[model samples]
Target: MFKAYRFVFIAIIACFALTQCTSVPKRTQTPQERPDVQQQTLDLEDAKSSADWLEEAWQAPNDIAKNSALVQAALTLQDEKEWQKSAAILARLDKNQLTNDANRYFRLAKGRWYAHNQQWPQVYKTLEGLPEQFTQKEYKRLTLELLAFAAGERHQYWQALAWQVEAQRYSDEPSPNALWQTASQVTQSQLPAERPRDLVLAGWWRLIDNHHQAMTSPSAFSALLDNWQNSFPNHPARERVNSWVSSDSQSNEVDKSTNTIIAVLLPLSGQYEAQGLAVRDGIIAKVSETKSYELVFIDTHQLSFEEQQSKLEELKPAGVIGPLLKGSVTEWVRQTSLNTPQVFLNQIDADTSEATANSHSIFFALNPETEAEQASEFMSSASSRTKRPLVLAANTPGSQRMVERYKESWSGINEPSVSLFSQRDDMKSAVEASLGLVGSKERIRAVKIAAGKIIVDEQERSRRDISGIYLPGNLQQVRLLKPFIDVSISPFAERIPVYGTSSAHELTNQLGDNDLNGLIFSETPWLVQNGGQNVLLNQWLDARSGWELSQARLAAMGYDSVDLLQRLPIMQRMPGTHWKGLSGVLSVENQVVNRQLQWAAFKNGSITVLEEQPNAGKNNR
Candidate 1:
């Protein structure tokens, strides 16, 4: 009779059910179930307090009252949230002293204690394969409820739903809201192969959410229910839907904005104005390709940070994106109070990665660290026979950043990587040092000095321990650095494969890139897909050149940002889905956007995309 109201109290646990239970096991009895002991428990109508029960257990060893009073004390402890003490009270009791019913009570209580402490796996293990008779009839309903809650936490949503439904029929412990939440998690955690079952569950949740309509107007709800039943006639939820027994108040009131209005926080007039404008153009270009969304552009230079913030509040958009610099992104995340989902154009450092976790935001930085890590994984998988690698980098800030990240990526190798910063004062010497050639030559000179004579061994050569090279720099630098590496290691090692990031070269200038022959690297679709020849993309690229990140590539980045916003819901709803955009094959997880890049190489002086490692596209991360 109280099932309908039971869910309203799920958040407020009921201690009375626990404290008042004196249930005995149903199927069997033992020495403890003797008539005298049963009568002793019932006779204690004005029983001593839980403390007095504890005293009775120790003072009256074999007394029948001792066994009965101890059970009461455990219940009293459980009611007070002294879960460990409650379980301990049962554990210390003698197995021989417990009747079959008493044993059942102790096991069920211990299992419930684990659930209360969120030790879900322990709860499952404790309750697994227990006979139906093990749980007293009066306690079975709550046991089933605890089992269901634990199942949901472990992602066994199907089993969780089944257990919860059975529990609700016995006693609606987890209300419709809690049950519906379990259903939604099941949907998100489901496999793509399970889409049919997922949809059926989704339909059931829809019916549950419309419970008010089902009750207020039976005919209308019946029609909807009938349509639902027709779609999934064999669905387990059919009976629940047909019953029309649910509360509309149980449905979630989470924000469901379509995100029609977007407030952009990019610099349109200042130092970063060019890049910001390029991104804005890309955002604008996507307007015709998909759903209509209003873009409100606020130039960072024209408006003060506070003024920009004030304008954001004034517009009250469904989403916010930008503040490209790391510092701006940091401040905005710290102070922003808006509840809508916001995408920052930069990544927060380790400290900020944790801080933004609670905010309605995600990091979408163009971080090379992720790229470097993936590159390491790719190269490591590509070959182990080619000798350990050499890392040659320029002295500029960007080059150093890439080299540092590369060092982090390759930190696991037993054969140490030779990393050297080129002063550009002498590229040849730098490459030789990176290959250990300089060290080898210096050793030979030291040996000569020690002997006080000059003796050259004809077979002696520079150290040949390396197999490949990783150089991250501009196209000009790569063109200049590759040959030095090739010649420096010629005597001792064969010219190994040279790898680079996409930023190292412009594949569009095929004529000038003849010098980049044999270079292997990863590329976004924008660079690999015929120079992103789509007419709409070209138009935006033409107008936005020389803007912040004036390169057409940055313009492509701008375009992807907008397209990603529009498809956010689809990606979230079906997490396994991928959007093959200009940037890469994009996917979203834990709020961060991920890209699966393609491999390419300069073949015969013209770029050729590699089909050698088909499985390499998926990120190991």
Candidate 2:
């Protein structure tokens, strides 16, 4: 009986040992057995929950030193499109230790991030770095898909189509087919009816059609029109499409004929009649001789807003211009729906939102912002020649606007030392202060006595050191500031330069034969001796009967404006090309005009053109 009890006790001990060895926790597995144990645990946990598997794997002790847990987590985040997090995880993997699968997955995640950011260049960079062995059909498929998307974003429609076509070799997906269809719509003249929903495609089609009409490419345009008609046989937009095609065809033919109506809308008998007539003359002179266009003039004189509207409605002109008074412009814009392009001859009260809104359909002849930019470039060049600049103006609206523009223009270049002087009772003191002589006791004493003559003379002597002066006041006001000018010019009149605007023409009359002898500035054509003789100038002059004076710059502006419409397709690309006229050299791009003003120095009681600067195209001009 004792022997039998011993055998049973031995068997029980064996059973306990077997249970402990077989059911041991994965964490406690022997070093050699750890991988197997962990694998078993991973299988069981994966069967239950991937989330639980990740949690347990992350919690595994250092004995389980593989990066499997981190990699799995990364894959999870990447599957959810959480690209940044996935990239962070894959970055931690030692490249030499990375398996083929891990490398492929890592590249896939990075490519996706780049594609999301529309970084086409970076996408290509990443794809190029993948291992040669990773070039599986799946990788090619994904690469092509992303390549197509990036190409489209970059406006490379042809490349986009090629990529989509290549992608089709690997995947039978409808998305790639749709992308190809859309690309074709953009790059090809003909398009299928069942194209994918793409707003860009529609915009491209419209742009191409408009361009074809503008360039008089009838064959290309007709083919596109026919294709569109056939594609949308029963489409609701058929009427609008037909109308555009027909109108464009007729307009193109008419544009070539002498019967082309060029309408002029100016204030013939209003307060600003003189200025209006100048602009009118400028337009008529150009077209009257050119058989290509017929000139039509409409005077907005003694007409109420409603009457102006009625007249415009009755006279369906091909194009219109002017109505110089700000109030008159507001009324005309409100009443006229001629669908004709109109040009505003002068600056309007920008405070009027309605007039500005009208600019969408009509072109503004001069944009203050554009003017300021040009002025800045001009000032920058001038500033380089003269290190010191003085801005002189009154507290009037025109003066204030000019001052602001001057400041903006000067800000872009090496800023010149600036001093502002007011045209008030304290003008003398302000002038001295601007010259940096007011605070000096000796300088003050010199100008304080002898009818303030000594100081004026001394200040004038010191003022000659200044490089240039920007005078924003009218000629009358400028003459009033002559004493101040004398302070700067008395000693160095030939060396010290003065600059003024079109207003300076009035001041020019006030100056002695040599008073403004060294001054250089801009003026309207009417203010100058050679007011009206260029072929371009005659166009504007002939528009109106009277020789009402205009800013000399107007002639150049008119030519640039008309020339832009004539060369719209290449406008953006033709920046540096010079458009010479009475005003000066003009640089135009994308319908934006930048004037390269010729430097005219006052010499021997007359203005002489000095140097002609190169127009910097769209840059500085």
Q: Pick the candidate with the highest lDDT.
A: 1
The alpha-carbon lDDT assigned to residue 110 of candidate 1 equals: 66
Tens digits of lDDT, candidate 2, 307-333: 766766666555555555666665665
CA shift at 97, candidate 1, in angstroms?
A: 43
403-440 per-residue lDDT for model 1 (tens digits): 66665556223333756554665787777777667777
True lDDT of residue 615, candidate 2: 30
Off by over 4 Å in 2: 1-259, 334-337, 347-360, 364-373, 382-388, 412-425, 441-467, 480-483, 489-495, 506-513, 524-597, 613-621
Candidate no. 1 TM-score: 0.56
Clashes of each: 4, 31
lDDT of 1: 0.59
Using TM-score, give the best candidate's number: 1
TM-score per prediction, in order, is: 0.56, 0.50
